[model samples]
Target: MISKEIVVANKTGIHARPASMFVKTATQFKSNITVTKDGKTANGKSLITILSLQLVKGSNITISADGADAAEAVDTLIKMVESKFGEE
Candidate 1:
């Protein structure tokens, strides 16, 4: 398993578009991806699960992955978060 924390730099956080992009990126990996915030963890590959988190700006989220390609998955996710989904 691998995990990394990222602060939401996007003003709107992981709202709508960003969440969609995240879900898309997650599905590209074979690893099991999960994102947690405020004690709530959601499946990264599922759009509904991510949307359910209701992540907002400045929120601290931990993105984790396990199984095959775990490290690569986590790294890609971290890049996405750092990019702020182009929202910031």
Candidate 2:
């Protein structure tokens, strides 16, 4: 397993578009990915679960993955979050 923490930097946080982009990226990996916030965890590949996080600006989140490509999956997600899903 691998994990990385990041802060939500986008103005709108992980709203519909960003959550959709996140899900799209997550589904590409063979690893099982999860996003966590304040002890709550969600399947990274599911749009609904991610939206449920209600991530707002400055929210702290952890992206984690397990399986063959765990490290890659975590890194990719960390980058995506750090990039603000390109919304900024």
Candidate 3:
């Protein structure tokens, strides 16, 4: 398993569009991915679950993946968040 902590950098954080994009990217990996905020965790490949995290700009999140591609999955998602999901 691989995990990384990243701060949400987008203006709107993981809103609908970003959540969709996140789900899309997450689904491409075979790893089991999860997004964690505060004390709650959500399925990374599920839009509803991701949005339920209510992430906002500057919110801290931990992305974790468990599988053969765990490291890649965690890295990719971390980059996405750090890039502000192109919303900036």
True lDDT of residue 8, candidate 2: 94
Model 2 TM-score, all chains together? 0.97
Worst lDDT run of 10 residues, candidate 3, spans: 5-14
Clashes of each: 0, 0, 0
Candidate 2 accuracy as lDDT: 0.93
Compose the digit string of candidate 1's lDDT tens values, residues 44-84.
99999998998888889999999889999999989989988
Error of 1 at 67 (Å): 1.2
Tens-place lDDT per residue, model 3, 1-88, is 8999988887887899989989999999999999999999999999999999999988999999999999999999988888888887
Clash pairs (backbone) in predicted model 3: none
What TM-score would you give candidate 1 relative to the actual structure? 0.96
Query: lDDT per residue, candidate 2, 4-88, as tens digits?
Result: 8899998988899999999999999999999999999999999999999999999999999999999998998888888988877
Per-residue lDDT of 24 in model 1: 96
Write down the worst ten-residue block by lDDT for model 2. Answer: 79-88
Give candidate 2's total backbone clashes.
0
Q: What is the lDDT of residue 3 in candidate 2?
A: 87
lDDT of 3: 0.93
**Which 10-residue window in model 1 sums to the lowest lDDT?**
79-88
